[model samples]
Target: MTTNPYDDIAEWYDDRVRSAWGHPGDESDLLAMLTGLTGDVDGLDICDLGCGQGIVSRRFARMGARVVGVDISSRLLAIAAREESANPLGVEYVNDDAQSLSRLSGGSFDGVVCTWSMADIEDLDSCYRSVERILRPGGWFVFLITHPCFQGPGSRWVGAERVVVDYFAEGFWRSENPDGVRGKVGAHHRTLSTYLNGLVEAGLSLERLVEPCGIAPINASLPDTSKVPVFLAVRSRKT
Candidate 1:
């Protein structure tokens, strides 16, 4: 069986990769951004696409939303299930690809959230289509991804803490993981226009854009992020 990259690193991700997804005040945190976008989500039916280890899904449940966490990796779902069992947050976990949520019916969710996984998804356009199909009209699709303009495998630090990045370079790129979530992980990069266009093509209206930094938590080691954004979070409506 081909091993899923996320599955290989699920155990260490909470402590290692979690911060990369952002937190309450860290800016690019999709959960925090979603809360700000849709106030009072109590009783909302939410689907967490690409929900690795169910961290955000549990958070959504805590916010009084009925949450279902979905991912392509069984290993990650297993870890999420373990966490859910321990806490009993009433979050459902599913093992499935984000691009093909065939088990779910159309117009089923009130909102959807995906964080720190867009760059890694091979068929993001398909995922967007699925998200649009599953979300009711006016439902929100919130997501966060590494800022393609300033953060990627093509980025390098230079003198005076300057950043050299390839804004136009696009494709799969691999880099060594400093957090040991894995020795290496592959992330696909596309232009900012490409990301925005994908949503437009999928019938989602861009509502808000935020470039958040993880400076407070990671600036000591990744100082470049303090100067530039680490991630881009978007809130789109399926209207």
Candidate 2:
């Protein structure tokens, strides 16, 4: 079996995520955008793809959805399962890669959500295909990712302005700054078009797009991020 890159840093990453959630003033808009896109998931069967530590999955379960959180990292899933056991939200955590989702049944979900995890996935096309396969007819797929244009390889914040280099450079890249998540796990960089086109190819139609402006709590190193959009959220429907 292939070793999960997140297994070693699972505990550290969970702590960082929890700390970020505690700071109300530094909250990220991705979750808000997700809520707006997926209004009232009450009693809906929702899948939280690439769910780490059950953060977003718990929210969905609390909203009355039968949530199944899938992730590749066993360590992260352990944390998620432990939290579920303590809180009893009825969330089921499954250890599976987003690219395949071999454990999940096809057309079994009312909606699928991937928040801030698309970049971490290596095979964008395969992941999108899995998302499409898992959703019921007309089921929505909502996702939020770092703005690829401004957050790609060699991109950084200089003073109050954002500097972007190699925007067209696609593939795996890691940030030099060790404090950031990208610096730790690295990410697959793809153009905005690549994401949209890939979705279309996977039989998911783009329904809505949101470029939210706010400084993500995790992006402390990128100052003045509010001046520009830091995250891109999209709502797509299976066709």
Each model's TM-score? 0.87, 0.94
Residue pairs with clashing backbones, model 2: none
Best by lDDT: 2
Q: Which ten residues in a row have the lowest lDDT in candidate 1?
A: 23-32
Error at 16, model 2, angstroms: 1.0
Residue-level lDDT tens digits of model 2 in 40-143: 89999999998999899988887899999999889999999998888899999888889999999999999999888999898999999999999999999999
Distance (Å) between predicted and true CA of 196, model 2?
A: 0.5
For candidate 2, give the lDDT.
Answer: 0.88
Predicted structure 1: lDDT: 0.77
**RMSD of model 2 against the true structure:** 2.2
Q: After superposition, which runs of candidate 1 have C-alpha atoms over 4 Å from their true positions?
A: 1-3, 17-31, 159-162, 176-183, 213-215, 218-220
Candidate 2: where is the Cα deviation over 4 Å? 23-28, 215-222
